[model samples]
Target chain A: MVERALLLCLLLIGFWGVVAKKNIIKKIFGLNILNAAAVMLFILEGNRIGSEAPILESGLAQVVDPIPQALMLTAIVIGVCVTALALALAVHLYQITGSFDIETIRERIQDET
Target chain B: MGKRKAWSPTLQACLAIGAMGVVLLPVFLSQTPWPTVARDYLMQYGQDESGARNLVSAIYLGYRAFDTLGETIVLLVAVIGTMGLLSRVESLVNTVGDDDNTIQTVSAFSLRGDKRSSHVLRTHLLEVVTGKIGPIVLLFGFYVMLYGHLSPGGGFQGGVIIASGIVFLALGNQQDNTSALSKSSILGGIESVSFLLFIIVAMSGIFFGKGFFGNPLADSAYPVGFIVLLNSIIGLKVGASIGFMCIAMMGGHD
Candidate 1:
């Protein structure tokens, strides 16, 4: 229950970051935090009673679910890719506009028109 | 200062909070547990069937190889997109030269101001340390990749490790002279070849009478070899692709 609450709190914080922040970099970081929270939630859900690592060891009875871990591994890599792409786009945006502030960029665009 | 707001910040925050609450309500209320049928089957026969003692490896390389292939493609697409975008800026800078001051300022920011004096003792120490540790980190990455089936680490982890080592080397080297280590073309070549090899191996399984990406060696006593091969290929592909991406992205900055 505590873990679930913590995960939810993290998700909410990330949501706040994404919604409230104007800086593009902060938005990217919020996206990352959101990804991390989801990954952790999946891993946490896979935890079982008397569960052990999925490695085949002698006389081991219960092993935690490996499927989630495998899927989450893919998710983590995809997250990295997304972060990289977003940062590259941010760099391009920064190049076009002198500032990272979204409002400033918007005003600059309007003035140009 | 009196611009009309699309929606008040409080209203947006309340909407966000409400949406989050609605989304999480079901998860908090019900405890529909994960089905154990697949997990049980995997735990029982995973080793004998997939020849990987680590069940996660079996799932990743054997049962779900198709998913892994798709994931690699996703990574490839992302790298290509980033490089394409960055290359446009490079060409723009090259064509414009110093005519536009704004472009000059943009390029300067993008370059990250690595204009440090080379004779600085602190810079020399950093260079020496990164130069020494780089090879060791790379070797360790290979070890993790090769031993993935038996250990916790896998191609993705090892590949990231290797890329970080390359990044360290790239960062330590002076900006004016390109480092011997930062060969983007060579890294790109390795990435393409390894991805092709991975696909070829996957296709070979189909031709060998095993289903697509099926373990042809499952009939043999040591089916782990196939998993190991896939792991190595994945490691090389990921490491090269990430390393190339890093080099390409930083290439402009330097």
Candidate 2:
């Protein structure tokens, strides 16, 4: 329960970073943080049922749920892909506007028109 | 100023945080117990069914293989999008470099020195270390990828490691004998070829009447062979795509 509380705080922190940060790079960091929190939360929840890792060996006790771990694998991969795409977009924006700040970029774009 | 800053940024942050908390409170507070049905069933027959000692591997590479296919497709698309945007940025930079006044020109830097210790670019010592360690990391990545059925690591983990190795190789390209794997064209070719091979293997299961992504070797003594093959294919695809993206991001324009 305490762990879940901590993860919620982490989620909120990441959300705040995304919402409040003016820099596009910082926003990408926030997204990665948010993704990390969600992944950790899912793995934690899935771990509630057992004490062992999902790898099977002879005479081993009950293992934790592999389903959530498996699902989280996909989530983590997608998160990486999303982060790469986001960073690429950020770089492109920087090249275009010569600024990392979202507000500055927007203002510059507006001026270009 | 249009509105004289009517609402403070802090107030807006507070509102967003409060709304987010309201939305997520239920999820964090939920007391519903984790179900055990699937876990129990997987424990009982996962090894026998998939020939994988690792149940996680069994689930992803066995039951939910189509999902893995989709994940790979997503990775491919992300790489494609990144490379596309990157090429545009490259061309933009090149056009800017047409003017002699632009100090950011690639040619301008190369003419400065044989060992370019640019503001944030590589150092000689770092290059040497990364170049030495890169191939070993790649070897370990293949090891983990091949033995994933019985171990903790899998295609995704090993593939990420392999990407790091490729990044290392690219970073250490000041030396001879390092240009081959770091070449964007070769990396792109590897990614495309592996994706094709993945589809071919996936379709091979159909000819064996094992349905889509079904283990064609299920009846054989090496049912886990299918998992191993899939892991390698996935590892190659992931590593190549990510490596290509990283190389491009590092301004390996070719």
Candidate 3:
């Protein structure tokens, strides 16, 4: 329960960073934090039913659910893809506006028109 | 007045996040039990069916292989998008010889040390250390990738490590960044070829009457051969694409 609360706090912290942070890079950082919180939550849930890792060794039962772990691997890869794309977008924005600040980029775009 | 204006947005953001948290509270606090039937079933037959000791590997590379293919496609799309976006953004990183006053920007792939003979910041130690360690890391990545069926690591994990190894190789070359692995063209080729091979292997199962992503070697003495092949292919594809992107980002042209 305490772990869940801590993960919730982490999720909120990531949300705050995404919503309140001005720098696009920091926003990406927050997005990763959010991704981490999610992956951790899934893993934690899977841990509830197992005393061993998902590897099948001799005389080992009660192994954690491998489904969540496999699913989370896909999620982690997708997260990486999203992050790389976001960072590239940020770079393009920086190249255009010459600033990482969201307000400044908005102002630059508005001025451009 | 200005201070209050700055503080108000923070407060608003907090309230918004708090609202989201409240809405998500039931989800986080839910006491429902996770289903164990799948785990139990997989534990009993996953090894025999997939020939993988690691059940997680068995799931991704065997039972849910179609999802792996989809994820790789997503990764490829991301790489393509990044390449298109970063082509124009290269000017941002290729800032060589604009300022001669304080610090000179050298490309990470630059082979000419004589061009940068002024006030070096002790880069020799870093170069020597990472240069010696890069190939070792690549070897370890391959080891992890190949042994994933029997171990904790898998294609994605090993691939990320391999990409890091490539980055280290790119960074370590003080005289010449001629490592074939660091070249974007080579990396791109490897990625493309591996993806093609992955599809070919997937379709090969169709000819064997096992359907897509089914193990064609199910009747062979070593059924695990298919999983190992898939793991290696995925690892190479991921490592190459990521290394390609990282090299491009590091301003390593050609």
Candidate 3: clashing pairs of residues = none
Among these predictions, the greatest DockQ belongs to 3
User: Which stretches in model 3 have alpha-carbon errors above 4 Å?
Assistant: B1-7, B93-112, B115-122
The estimated TM-scores of all candidates read 0.88, 0.92, 0.93
Q: Which tens-of-lDDT digit does each residue in B1-254 have in candidate 3?
A: 25444557878898899898998798788889999999999999999999999999999999999999999999999999989888876565344344646453333334346653332442678778888999999999999999999999989989998998998898787666478888788999999999999999999999999999989999888889999999999999999988888877766755
Clash counts for the predictions, in order? 0, 0, 0
Each candidate's interface RMSD: 2.5, 1.6, 1.1
lDDT of 3 at A92: 85
**Per-model DockQ against the true two-chain complex:** 0.59, 0.74, 0.82
TM-score for candidate 3, please give it: 0.93
DockQ (model 2, Cα): 0.74
- TM-score, candidate 1, chain B alone: 0.81
Tell me the lDDT of candidate 2: 0.86
- Better model by DockQ: candidate 1 vs candidate 2: 2
lDDT of 1 at B137: 90
Candidate 1 Cα outliers beyond 4 Å, as residue runs: B1-6, B91-125, B174-180, B252-254
Error of 3 at B144 (Å): 0.4
Model 2: per-residue Cα lDDT over B1-254, one tens digit each: 69575788888998999999999988986889999999999999999999999899999999999899999999999999998887887644444534434455332222223534452345678778887889999999998899999999889888988999988886665534446777888899999999999999998889999988989999999999999999999999889988888877767656
- Candidate 3 structure quality by residue, lDDT tens digits, A18-111: 9999999999999999999999999999988997999998899699999999999999999999999998898889878888999999999999
lDDT tens per residue, model 1, B1-254 = 56776878778887987798689867743578777888899988999989988888999999999889999999999889888777756533443345532424333322433433322232567767876787889899998888889988888888888887876676555444555556777778888999999998888788769978988787887999899999999998888878877776654332
